[model samples]
Target: MSFPDEILIAGSGPAGLTTALSLHEAGFKVRVFEAVPEIKPLGVGLNLLPHAVRELDELGLLAPLAAAGVACHELAYFTKRGERIWGEPRGLAAGYQWPQISLYRGALQFTLLNAVKTRIGADRLHLGRQLTGFDATPGHGVRARFLNRATGHEETADGRLLIACDGIHSAARKIFYPTEGPPRWNGAVMWRGVAECDPVLDGHTMIMAGHTRVKFVCYPISSQATRPGAQQLNFIAELRYDTTELSEREDWSRAGNLADFLPQFESFRFPWLDAPAMIRAAPAVWVYPMVDRDPLPRWTHGPVTLLGDAAHAMYPIGSNGASQGILDARVLTGCLRHHRADPEAGLTRYDAIRRPATTQIILSNRQQGPEACMQLVEDRAPNGFQKLDDVVSRAELDAIAAKYKQLAGFAIQELNTRPSLASPTA
Candidate 1:
């Protein structure tokens, strides 16, 4: 049997849209299916590290992203008492060719969606189509079925390959791993919100305060949120609950009440920023469990494969979840271009390379990744220290940060020197 001309992609989020764009640039026809009836700018903020930014830059999206987001200049770690644990320049400030962008997740999604519609054509993107099941045809291609949420009708689409970018609760992944359940919660709950507030530290700095038990992370995601002097700050307040049982259903859009989690940060005020005040000032908050799926031994079965969260869902540490997914899109496009004669060989190669690479990152995030510095200081000097180095040496802090960057494939020197993931024509 000969290979089909087009590839079918499930989920029109970052990973799926990116794969569509990358594959199109590589001279392949692609179609994207999204479950939602309509797409909107509805998600909270997320950071696009330099590595991910580079890929977007190659796709000609850097200008629009910079307009919608703030370029992060530095990342800092602090104790509960406001003492600085570690600080380092990031993105272009750290000498990378690209800038680290902090932006609304929804904004980024819409940007990619528009690009897909314009370049891949609007007819190729099918919304309101929820992936139901898929089957690999022996010596042929794959057949994927989707349910129209609005009509309750089922439809089938065939392509040379099926790529699942449907997020953590992927229907395709569930079909492959029938015994595996929902994402595993690690007993920590996070309340995320965005508010217009005075910038903390430098206007471009991202900060992580406190430790594993109670933590607050804040960064300026958009300069357009308010006037020139103020910016829109995105924040997450996380606390470990005693119970192991999952209480609420896992949904990113789930609304959170301040009454439940605000008390935990009542005494979390510092000179640089008032944690409680920021929480109170925010118009809305979203609550979600800090959850991740156990890494699977394989992400490919014949001509079908997984990408992004569908492949490896890890703790949201080091800001690498979306970044890794972007990386996967590029690598998978490269594989398909190289092994066009035997598309199955390309899927196999993509699985071989990314599965292990992302597995190590999943394990590293469990150990706290770059955020480990905060935990070290909390363990050594819970009472607050006059000197940071006395609690945790600079060398120890530096090593932790560097190791995570390396694991996430964004070490400063290496990322700057790496070859472009774009095709020669791109």
Candidate 2:
């Protein structure tokens, strides 16, 4: 028999799926609504920091992540001409109990989705349902409306709480901040793609080359054996424009024109990898304007609140786009479990813990976060440095990295010892 306390989840992406899984583990009923008719592996590569990996490990997904993705060994920064500026051990190499992972964004989403379906039942996830509006009746909980895309009819579902994990264009968020316009652009556009290629440095390294304006990010996401010794390489080509206006809204499926950004990166040839050859190898490319919303003063309004991108959408810098969303899911779940008697209090507490944290990330990413080193190198030694120390010291580089890890809640020492976020231990 279904109870009146069932949780209603809007959006079935990683955060939403994870939310349902966590709630189910704590003996709460959850139903997820998604706008997409079919959930397929979409989007390019993303990295999971140790903090985010810890949450997934709690959900019993560490093994699957390793099977489908690469356990990143190191991360490095370089000049546009490919001169190394800074490099450091990453994931387990950096001494965290959890390993940082690099994988296709779709892979991680499905990992969480599959877990939810098996544990919460496939029927719990309602596809083609777009969240339109929601009414939260203080103590009684929420009654939400949705547009059933397949049938083209409005439907309603009542639940004890509503969590909106919808993406940046979240319908629920729009309702709360109707005066807010489209996502704010940062004058940069990214062309992302994955290709089969030989390993660059260690077969498991993530590298960011170039500076803030024009940059190239590449890493081996998986070793799925494309050829005799080839692995799938994920790369992003970013360029800053004088104008901040994005004619087309961001879409992961939008195909990019080769002539648009290839020439800018063709000259990035290095002994470790050929620049032009790798770009030409990809089957297709997707484009997105670097955009994010100003952090809202609040995320919870009675029994209805937001999570993931709907709550905090930061720039891709610092590899926290999806990682932070994963953290939000776990933290929010822990809060809800602690305040089971008063679910409204749970929503308020979650907003207090997560909103301020992600707000800092949003502002830091605008300044390039730890990636500021790339821009600094470009400023001081644009002509290429004979010695990287002359451009920036190891102490300066380490401090920048440490500060970001602390802010992002993944400093090696802290993350290794931080207590588990999932309640009932999955």
Where model 1 places Cα greater than 4 Å from the true spot, the runs are 1-3, 422-426
Instruction: Write one digit per residue (lDDT tens) for candidate 2, span 55-152.
Output: 88988889998788999999999889988888889999999998999999899988888888888899999999999998778888788999999999
What are the lDDT figures for the candidates, one per model?
A: 0.90, 0.89
RMSD of each: 1.7, 1.9
Stretches > 4 Å off in candidate 2: 1-3, 423-426
What's model 1's lDDT at 345?
A: 84
The weakest ten consecutive residues by lDDT in model 1 span 417-426
lDDT of 1 by residue, 1-426 (tens): 454667999998899999999999889889999999998887789999999999999899999999999999999998888888889999999999999999999989989998998999999999999999988974479989999998999998999999999999999899999999878888899999998999888899999999998999999998875566888999999998887678766999999999989998988898888989999989999998999999998998997999999999899899988889999998898788788888788888888878999999999998898998999999999999887767778889889988888888898889888777654211
